[model samples]
Target: MTKILLETLKGNPSDRVPFWFMRQAGRYLPEYREIRQNAPSFMDFCYNPDQATEVTLQPIRRYGMDGAILFADILVVPDGLGQKVWFEAGHGPKLTPVNTEETYAELSLNGFHDKVGNVYETVSRLSKELPEEVTLIGFAGAPWTVATYVIEGAGSKDHAAVRQMGYGNPELFGKILDLLVDATSEYLCAQIDAGANVVQIFDSWSAAIPEPYFHKWIIEPTREIVARVRAKHNETPIIGFPRLSGAMLETYVLETKVDGVSLDTGVPLDWARDSVQRHVCVQGNMDPHLVVSGGDAMVNEATRILDTLKGGSHIFNLGHGFVPQTPPENVALLSETIKNFRR
Candidate 1:
């Protein structure tokens, strides 16, 4: 039998629903925080195979999740592309913004693998260590999302700055997108070589653009990356997480050709079962906040999604990462609630 997570992605129903969470390995768990102290910086922790590998395995040991996603930041590509990338304890990722060709010239693909080698080591370790039943998902931020940080230097409220640069100077913006496409494709292909069973591309910022801009920046670039990855690794499943691409989700699934599409909390279950799942396996749509609330709302939402998508191929997962303030027991309760549900 196929591992539940992969089998579901292959258009087969599982004996029980397979479960995993976005940002499954991160600040929410104390063990992850405890281990973070042992490394010099966030990037150090991500680059240190031992430390990264430990954090990657922490959730699997605690929650017995159906899949263990690698522990590494999506901004690692920026660091690989020769931009200085870092995290401020309270602030989030910062990078050297590439606004011009002169600035873009500073980024070199030379030794890109050497720069992010620890990520590969983390994948290699998890593959050998994870239980056979639990699949290991490897991932990277999509070009548009990662490029937002590279162009804006940090997270933004409206992403107005980058979108302006994209609109104002299409050529320069196109160059950066092209670089990211080449670099991200190489990076993900390398992760597969290192031992990632499934690779997910996180296009978290796709929803911000209007339809025309969406096709140019989000859909086309993602389609290219997926096609490139498939050329070399046909067996590995690629799940696309276009965080808030609600109405256009079906278009992305068909055009990008990803093996699965991760639904955010805003997507309706009935719409997903009738539309998105007919094309590719669907994963996620649970409200992480509801899981945090952990009462009747949590159980009801979980049951509704499962019931709606029952006969179709689906995986149970949170709409986004488990937040740091979430009570651990809530996660446990939600996990159990999902396991107990059946058609």
Candidate 2:
């Protein structure tokens, strides 16, 4: 087979640009909605291998993406560690904060796998069901990214709470990062064993931190995870998506040792081609909002991304996941454009 994603990650030319998006298997699709109905709750669906596998495969079946990512949230790591994590209808995820060394010490890694076992089951199912040509991707939010939710208790536009906590009490913060490095590495390795062909670490909040803190919290912890995972699962490619870390993108890719780096919407293409492609496979940089407003505008922007990055290792994808308001037809058109592109 086709295995275009894997080939492209290795810097080989593919028959077409291998494509998949961040949150590709999320709320944008109707099948995902139907599957979500069967899930007891958001966490229930994630912890249920069968439902998780169904959601994971939903977008792949509908769009024929080059990759199929597991449908589980990043906060599952915190939940597994004895922190109380929940999702309110409109408010994204929330976790009971672990602010002190004593509290962090109280959390245990024992039975962590058992708690999140369905994730491995979902990976196993996808391995057997997916066509040999399509790559199966498994992922988790990186340590620093997960920490933001754990400390702040939910999504925030500024991430001020976590940053201040990191600045005020780095010792405790460092301990949490350490625990995450160990936990996330083991979690991803388990996914590889369960048959995930690739693993991507989502450092969604990396850009929010200042330079020094960014290196200490975001870059360092991520590098440790990459090195640990690569020690055992060397062949399993890792993609690092440090969302919004514009100027620091090249440095993050070089220092973190990830096999691929995913760019957010605002990252300039020329910078990506010259700086990033030299270090690792690059995926993304298209605005998801444009997909919501599809037509010639979306088509032109998509073509421009492809034309600029055509000669290098690239994966066609939206800068982020599609929004709930996105029309199903828009997704179909975007998929068709990528699959049918001549280059």
Candidate 3:
């Protein structure tokens, strides 16, 4: 079967307008809740190949999404590396703070693949089981984004701790990023070997970095990872999501050499079309909250994005992942809108 999503990711926008949302099969779906009950903890759920494959396929089965993202968390990288990691109820992911290079060095690749092998297995299963027309997307948190969790020990409002650490001990902080670059490259390559058709690098916290250091912190590591992944899987397309990177996004696209880039809710539609789309495939910019609203409110925004970006190589998607409170019916409506679009 021809993969429309794959074609779009390679910078070819079909009249069909291929699409898949971030966090497509998570808390919003009732079926996912049923499966979640069977796992002891969130990280445990991610590690179980059977459960992970099921949740990843749930959205594809429900909505016939053109793409199916692997069901896992970004923190899994640190957990696999031997860092103390866990998800606390209500509060979110907790970890042993990695401040000094000494604590950071304790993270090793000795049995790293062994620990995270379930993720590769999940990819292997999804590859064979998904509809031939659907694209299998594998992903990891970008080095800078994952390092934020490592340094701060959890999600932070401003990522002040990691920034302070970078300023105070540039050598120690540089060491953490360098290690993640090598490890993350191996992780993504192993996923491709397992049968991922395409992979995405999620720099979810890139927005938190100031302009002066964005190149050193975000672009540099991501560029290295892209080069490493391409060395092993030359044909696999990579999408970069530098959320809220603002005007800097154009520079990132040129520097990182990604096949595609996911836009955050803040990027302007016409600007992205005129500036970025000419160079690479553009994947998003819609607000996730509109889907929670549902009805005409959701349809109108989805329609606007479809109409505006129809001129270029575009893949319909949210600016970010879904929130738990989102109504499933809204996703259904959004799917309907995409299927009916023509440009």
Candidate 3, 68-119: lDDT as tens digits: 9999998888888899999899899999999976798789888999999999
Q: Say which candidate scores most in lDDT.
A: 3
lDDT of 1 by residue, 1-343 (tens): 2578877777767668899988777777899889987788989888998888888888888888888899898999989878999899789888878888899989889989989887998899988988888888899999999889989999998888889989999998898988899999999999999988899999988876888888899889998999899999988899999999879899989989999989998998888999989888999889888877888888888888888888788899888888887777778877888788776
What CA root-mean-square deviation does each model show from the true structure? 1.2, 1.1, 0.9
* Residue 53's lDDT in candidate 3: 97
Q: Ten-residue segment with the worst summed lDDT in candidate 1? A: 1-10
Question: What C-alpha lDDT, on a 0 to 100 scale, does residue 241 get in candidate 1?
Answer: 90
How close is every model to the real structure, measured as TM-score? 0.97, 0.97, 0.98
lDDT of 2 by residue, 1-343 (tens): 9699988887786769999977788788888888887777788888898888888888888989999998898988888888888888878777777777777876779989989888898899999998899999999999988988887778888888777878888788888889999999999999999999999999887875779888999899999999999999888889999999989899999999898999899999998999998788899978999988999988889999999988788998878778888888888898898888867
Residue 115 lDDT in model 2? 90
Kindly give the stretch of ten consecutive residues in candidate 2 with the minimal lDDT sum.
99-108
Instruction: Sum up the clashes in candidate 2.
Output: 0
lDDT for model 3: 0.92
Backbone clashes in model 2, listed as residue pairs:
none
The candidate 3 region of ten consecutive residues with least summed lDDT is 7-16
Residue-pair clashes per candidate: 0, 0, 0
